[model samples]
Target: MRRHGWRWVLIGVLGLLVTGCFAPSGPRFGDGSAVPEEVSRVRLPVRPGPDGTWVVNSPGEGLLGQGRVLVRRAGPDRRGWRLALPAEFALTSQRPGSAHSAFVGDHSVVLVGGREGRRGPSEIAGLDLTNGRLAWRLRVAPDSRVFSYDEGATVLVADCRAGSCRLTGVSYPTGRRVWSRTAPGAVKVLDGCRADAFVADPVVGRAPCHPYLVTRDRVSLLDMADGRLYERPGLRIPPGGIDRITENHGRITLATAPAKGSCRATVVSESGGDGAQDLGWRYTFVWDQPQAPRDPATGCRWDRTLPLTVVRSLVLPDAEGALVLDPYLGLRKQLRRLAPGEYLTADETRVEVVHASGRPDRPLHPTRTPLRPPGLSPAARFLTRLLWQDGRRLVLLDHQNRPLWEAASACRAFMGDGEGPGVSLTYCDGPDLVTVRPAWKD
Candidate 1:
């Protein structure tokens, strides 16, 4: 009887080993299929610091406070500069005061409006990040608003009044004025080219005026060293006006509105001549909806009319400019339209229940998901925010929107807590983690 029991045990051990080898272990939710774990946190220690650590902080109050700005090392050096603000400064909600409108770079965090009680015109102040000191301040016309940042040369573009706008480049260390230029009309800086700045000359009119009628806007290339205009030429368009301009990989894509309705997009190579040779290709959208192209080469599809309310925000991925449709108030459906071929790629898109202020019987589904991790119980899932896409990977988060793990390129899942079924199981290898916050319970 002892020999027979020994044989049975050996057989069981062999079977277990083979199973482990063939079927890797991964997070298994209520659904039998293995769901990729959430990446609770990502720690990218490449920035070379005191153990390569960083922190994310938002001011406590007002417009400048609400903007979510990230500051990190400007380069690989430990003592290198860092940037604080992003390009856009608009507030999500209509707060009482001005919104957060600056990017921190190298030695300075650029501010839009003047100081709290200082009665003066709107100014761009470079605040020292190391000691929170004001390094330099440039007074902009009270009617002007500093909008965009040029990372190449650390230049800023502001919309000033009196048919004139200013483009100023400031030195990072001493905050001394490097160079400044005033344009012919009230030009809103659209995007930056290679050492050049693109501006949109707004038509002189009221709130709902046509933007195209005010043509003759110039795409001027400025020498970073001397702030001299390299090329300033008039770009002629058809009867319709330009609706929007998007920049990617040093190329400017002009989305032009149709005379009657709808819009078409044209890709202009920034390096080419200011004349007709600069126009690379033009694409027209058949439908009137704001649909971004799936791929950069193919452009957007205007034919397919999606229900207007179904779409939330359109994100153009990286320099390739592939458009990802973020649907907020609909059956969870995330769609990506590739350019060139105009092909559609669909991944996992599901709406999980989340809990906020209401009771379990009738929970609230907020449009914006709160940050959390994933793999909470049914009750906990209510308080969790669903992890969308991180770069190219799709992730699942917990109730507090903390990443549990992420599946990359449809394979190879990386978990945060280091618990999952996969071969490449490594902690702190997911999206570049700048900071880690305390997890919240459902």
Candidate 2:
């Protein structure tokens, strides 16, 4: 949960927050009336492509099958060309056991191909967006998430969910399996067949000790250099005890709920960096009632290593900004842990190193550039989107974030793709799809 005089807020699609009542004269959709049948048709507007070209997937935004990728290039007005799938490739999620899904890529799109029987392996196919031709077709035991080799690269890493699943790198143009190695557990990749997914964090170090994976039991790290996994000599995640585990520079923070005490975290070093010491006990639950959106410091581990000098109660103020905490990487806001030790904080102007015991230890990282990834904690999203629409004029709360700029309501939602820059915020007003450019600026 969270406590904040400076609380972080998240909102609908593109995660904008439209606060403070607007004057009736604020720019708004002309009438409460919906747009014509043509405009209201289900089409998922993707991040705009370069040179006035845009890609949109349709049949209403969803993970299941039922529409084609509609490519919209700027004409006298935006017109749809090249429907990615036709009658022959019409998709349906109806299956006996497996649920169908899809993931979109830069040059290709992948989806669960139609299957014949109720119980069988999951069939997937990738299509060349350029020609709307099938690039490759492969099958995973169950489901998968997409991963890419690098930015602007075509290679896709499908994180298949076959518990104890291994890594199999396939050639982009040809679906032939290139490299395969067994790790610990099933590789949990990010998305299905409609949106694009990329490597959240690339492997690091001279030997590359990353390509993170989570097993049925514990989280595992893979070394891409040799296909060998990292071994933690002193680390042992007590079975059935901790709810979540996170790693940062060989450090582990455990989020759990004990039968007796309130929900708390125990920080331990896997590499004996801190000599296997117990960092300290911090309770995530405020007032003994769980906070709506969990403050990351209470639940996940931050990417930054906690300084040894600051042992307890580190309070980092947001200074009026949003923090998105990944289940693994802590908070996008990155406060991480709060109160009881010294920690760092930031604002539009500067990043301050605050100490619970005293003052500054000299500013560690500066402002403007956050040391951590700004993620969307599921709690924050559920909590901040308390009220979105007010009467007619639809406005998005400009959290002033660079990576995102999409909007969602009961009426419609546009998915955000940090896959590339120039976030074009697209929102729907009845039948009309409106696009907003320059997502964030001065």
Stretches of candidate 1 exceeding 4 Å from the true structure: 1-99, 114-121, 147-166, 185-187, 193-217, 223-225, 232-243, 247-251, 257-271, 274-279, 284-287, 290-442
Instruction: Give a tens-digit lDDT track for model 2, residues 91-131.
Output: 43322112343444344455554445534335555555444
**lDDT values for all models:** 0.36, 0.36
Show where candidate 2 strays beyond 4 Å.
1-99, 104-121, 142-165, 183-219, 223-226, 241-245, 248-250, 254-392, 396-425, 436-442
Best candidate (score: TM-score)? 2
Query: TM-scores across all candidates?
Result: 0.40, 0.42
lDDT of 1 by residue, 3-95 (tens): 999999999999999998989543343222333433334344222223212222221110122333333322222232333343332212221
Model 2 misses residue 385 by how many Å? 17
lDDT (C-alpha) at residue 174 in model 2: 71
TM accuracy, model 1: 0.40
